[model samples]
Target: MDQITNDLKKSLESNDAYCLSELSTLFSDRALTDGPHINEDLNTCYGGVLNELHNVACLNGNEVWTSGDKDNIYLYNLKGDILKDFQTSSTSCIQDIAVTQSGQLLYTDDNNRSVNIVSNTQIDTLIKLNEWIPHGVCIASSGDFLVAMTSVDWDHTNVVRYSGSTEKYSIQWDDQGQPLFPAGYTTKYLKENKNLDICLADPDARAVMVVSAARKLRFKYTGSSSSITLKEPFYPSGITTDNYSKILIADMCNQIIHIVDKNSHFLRYIKNYNLRSPRGLRVDSKDNLFVAECYTGRIKKIQFYR
Candidate 1:
């Protein structure tokens, strides 16, 4: 761990973007060389109901949040123990969950077609669109909220930006005036890269769409056919970006997590880690990865950064 910290410090001192990018690959190689092994008994969190787990997010250093198919969202310790659970007052499945800049919890209320925010002991409606249904909710690095929304027919999908309840921006079309994303109800999970680019996982499209901070089309990453780590017909689900701009995508069909750089270049596959249907992913502040498995209802904590 000390070595990894020192390497990152040195890379930051150089102030070179290329050096930083190279460090991400170095981290991946080190983990692979050391034979990434899951400390099964030590890192697994297993208090969720069987086959009920849906999504997960890192709330803080000590707390990880998970939502199930029911109306409950649970907070658990790093070890396998339930700390607490909250009922959203609606029985519909919570599509996604995220933590706000002020330490508030945010989630998609699919039952009401709105984005809900939990602050202090009160859950309030943060953004409620009239005709649009919210799927994924994320707090941008700039402290604003980014939500993936779609129409009822799922024929149109786009991301909406909101500063509290007021609309700020909308990202829909590409640079050439084409639809930026394929119409689907599932292309929602999104995160802001270290460079402020928007990265989203589209399960229906089997691709990850990356857009510039200015809402311009940057690149689209389909799975690499030549790579042995990643399989074809990529069905990406939950997506996240670490502090180093490395994107972690959950491939549900392949049952593996693909790590990529800021440019959407393939870095490595986090395979052979005993993962089954990894649906939700979150990298904590200490670079510890928390993965939620849909089938087993377990959250696995891994030390990939070291």
Candidate 2:
């Protein structure tokens, strides 16, 4: 694993892929957990992975990890066995979670009020809200953190970066620096591309906006019909870019996973009638897709080839 990640970094340095500054931030030293595993224990909870999975990450000994509307994060081994069950002490439901390059877990609740760190033993509050609400959290390859936030007062939303657990940069409705959207924008999800770029799923704007490794707008990619536009299925809820450079979008309304090229070419849709309100989606090292069934409280595992 070290050799592979190092090779990826060297390739970035050599411009083999994109510069390290442009790809997603997966630091050189931090690894949450390793390998892929199935999670059969979840089957009883939602009738055989019914496909409403909310959030999934790699942690503990499992190749797969996930969290639901409930206040628990699950770590499952590669074979789909449950490992550690990290509970939130209190009955707070976590909406999204991001694993840093340092193997640190950071997340926010559905209400987007505070941020917490999930460890082997305890859950600690990293940041608190006197008024503002924090929505999503992401980790840069260099170990920095990017978070999506919103205002408690209005429809305003923004993104910010932090050093470790401290605020380093913030974006608001100021003429000085506006994020991918203005005040009305709501950033639901955030992830780092292989090139270290930050990809955000903004359902309101109905697009996937890209911020460079340096946190600058690289581009915004929407789906295509005859010419390349984000039309009906444009309401992107959950998003992830796979190893094949395909963007997998969870069209919550459409009940399918839409795959497009980096340039937003309409590839193919992974549609299954069973998926319901898939608010979160993730890909394991093996390229198998794990979806979080948001409403029904289920996690669906779809094998790419199978």
Candidate 3:
């Protein structure tokens, strides 16, 4: 039995496909846990250094990259001190921002029709699009990044995966041949769940769409019908997933953060800490949620999980 186990291990390690499949299943076994009875407010960092806090990307411990309706992106610590600031290559406003596992900063330049990376304070065009204008971006666990883009005419929208600068595939339509995402220039935030599910927060559709890693339609979570406080229509903007595979989405119009399970089950609502027009959501390695309030220009850090 020992020899057989060793042989099996060697075989798995030798095959990348088997190793990745096993690793994915191993991680998915960890189920989501119920959050704390009352979430704690950690700190509030002023992102008003920009015009408006549009998005946030977790860089490392207690540090995050923030962007607004401008070409410049600022890096700030939780203490509200600006660590670094860099401007995009294009003069137009940045659509979204994300940080790679290696701590590299990436942002979408819709006007330039490209995705760029910031290295050593220099901007490098990583992926250039001819027909689609990139908006939202997120780095997957596999190091591949996903970009949500709309066509030049703003008549079509989809999420495309890229391995470095090479296009792997795209998730555009459902099994029924219907569009997976709504068309338009509306912002669509993308994040990969622990279960390898591609979750997108589409504000134009007024729904949070979750698809399998293979691009299969898993589920769509509209707002909770039973909630009394959610008087406005569901307008999901920024999206993120925690260590427990729990998904959190920012509802800008309602000023609430909705938490859902990997299966799209409504878990709870985070409406504390005076979340005024929360537009971007990001969770750190420690499970601390950093919310970017658009109009307020503030980033609120909260410990929602116990």
Candidate 4:
């Protein structure tokens, strides 16, 4: 394992993509939990009324909102009490959900390719696309909606910004006019880092793609290489950013979360505590990490900071 780690480090330093790919393929079958795990323990695990939770959003660091395919969106308090249950517009499935700075509930309807907001009076469509499907939704620091959308064939993907139903900016093709992200149906979860850069997790590409505040490509971080051979592919699902600008991403297949610094340096893996297919991830203002375990229908609130 030590030798393999050393080799991976050398390969990374040399920018050897072929060597890294071969290493990943060779180790992609060991039990995902076999490697070194973090020592942090989950503060609480809440179950009941949650099934196939696809995403989570935190409001004021106390209230939590969970979305699923059950035709309902759930809101819960820190004590695990269900505060509200709001019905969705369709039964197909809610692709993603987010909480705006003003406390409004915003979500993407996958079946309708629409973005809606739950206001004090009613649910209304903020925007609807005819050629693309919305996969993930988040509120930027500037109070605009950052939505991840892809074409029907999954041949093209883009991050669009909407300011109250009007298009503001877009991030798709790079400066070279080439596609910036791989095409796929996988949901591309995204969030704004503390420094205002957009951090995106692309499961199809098995990598995290970062874009600068000015909408330029910053960097792309693939799964970090390790001495301990891995048994499965690096499938990043849910993604969020902490106050420190650390990017935390859920590795669904690997059953772990990868933590990366602001500059996109691989820091460490948060494992242990028997995380099972962890998905929807959010870091509260207090730095508490909330993880949604998909298959188990449970939410694990963990304290990653001392």
Q: Highest TM-score, which number?
A: 3
**Candidates 1 and 2: which is better by lDDT?**
1
**Least lDDT summed over 10 consecutive residues: which range in candidate 2?**
27-36
Q: What is the TM-score of each candidate against the true structure?
A: 0.85, 0.73, 0.86, 0.82
Q: lDDT-based ranking, best first?
A: 3, 4, 1, 2
- Tell me the TM-score of model 2: 0.73
**How accurate locally, in lDDT, is each candidate?**
0.76, 0.63, 0.80, 0.77
lDDT of 2 by residue, 1-306 (tens): 547666766665432244353223343322212232333324413222333346776543245567665566777665556666777754555767877665667778636377888676577888776666776676655577777876777467777777856987665433455545545435478776665666778787777776655545767766445633333566788887655555678877667667765544676666554777666777666566777766675566666542
lDDT of the structure predicted as candidate 4: 0.77
Q: Write the per-residue lDDT of candidate 1 for residues 79-168, one digit (tens) a residue.
A: 757787778976678889999877889999766888888876588987777778788778876588899888887898888888989998
Q: What are the RMSDs of all candidates, in order? A: 5.6, 6.6, 4.8, 10.6
How many clashes show up per model?
A: 0, 30, 0, 3
Q: Which regions in candidate 4 have their CA more than 4 angstroms from the true location?
A: 1-51
Could you say which candidate leads in lDDT? 3
CA lDDT, candidate 4, residue 113: 87
User: Comparing 2 and 4 by lDDT, which wins?
Assistant: 4
At residue 49, give the lDDT of candidate 3: 38
How many angstroms is residue 214 displaced in model 3 relative to the true structure, after the best TM-score fit? 1.6
